[model samples]
Target: MPFTPFHMGAGLAAKALAGRHFSVLTFGIAQLAMDIEPLVGMLRDAPVLHGPTHTYLGAVPIACVTAALAPWLCRPLLRRWNQEVRHYRMPWLQESERWSPQVVLASALAGTFSHVLLDSVMHLDIRPWAPWSDTNGLYATISLSALHLLCMAGMAGGALGWVALQWLRSRRAAQRQRHNP
Candidate 1:
């Protein structure tokens, strides 16, 4: 429903899985899921009684399936990154061995489920079990929902922008160093 929840759910999910992916899997997949049209279609319509996403038919299966597949989806790149994780001393990441497939899968499932559950609660119209009925919307928390999305969008977008700026700065610095050195 809201971008904040989506970001949080995805991020938390990735963290819970723990591995080379850190940000990529935890945040990336969650965001990717939201971006995907079929999953998004469930959100756009808001069928009834919480719609398809609310239903076990949809949410549970999704979580389960993703958990099963996250590794195959991420393995090679993850292996490469795991080899290099040592170079990064990010505050949030503690140095650890590459995560086991089982751990990553569990975390991915948790992340997907968390997103659906959180969204269902936030959007009153979220009929997670759609096709069964059309109970419409849950009316949302109004200003809170708006604020949540606004803040999340600003934060996520800001983070990406910040990274881009840093990259540019680094590039220029490198060029200057090359010319002066």
Candidate 2:
């Protein structure tokens, strides 16, 4: 599913579960990186659409590049969103929170690897191991409905978890302010 939101659902879950350890922006960049090969192939009508970029061998380097460059592009957007998400923002993070290198690397790797896994399930042409072997036994192992449901579940669960965490933080802040003020 190139350019689809299905990939984002996993990214959202990563952000919710990993919190500061994961960068959603970097994850998105990695997801786009994973699909770039196929997107170009489709545009040019190339014979091999999935290509090497969909393989594990390709994901490592792509993830690294995304990790290195994505933060620079995403930091500004994150800062803007951070400012807007007042309810979710930590008092100490007011205009100071930025995506660290560690967070960017981790999230990019997670996103690229997950993209390979998700695509491997649906695309018969995706040889995740590639060069070593050209077999894809994982193709259509599960129904499309099941895969879509899993993505949707991730989105719902991630949203709930994020909201809950923010609410708890806000509540704690309120309690502290009451006692201190």
Best candidate per lDDT, number?
2
Model 2 clashing-pair count: 0
Query: TM-score for model 1?
Result: 0.49
Report, for all candidates in order, the number of backbone clashes: 21, 0
lDDT of 2 by residue, 25-112 (tens): 7898999988989999999988888988998889999999998888678878867876776566554333334777788888899999
Those runs of model 1 whose alpha carbons end farther than 4 Å from true positions after fitting are 1-6, 13-31, 34-51, 54-56, 87-98, 121-124, 129-139, 142-181
What local distance difference test score does each model get? 0.51, 0.83
State the TM-score for model 2. Answer: 0.88
CA RMSD (A), model 1? 9.5
Q: Which candidate is the best by TM-score?
A: 2
lDDT of 1 by residue, 65-111 (tens): 66666666666666655566535743222223355666665555555
Estimate TM-scores for all models: 0.49, 0.88
Among all windows of 10 consecutive residues in model 1, the one with the lowest summed lDDT is 89-98
lDDT for 109 (candidate 2): 92
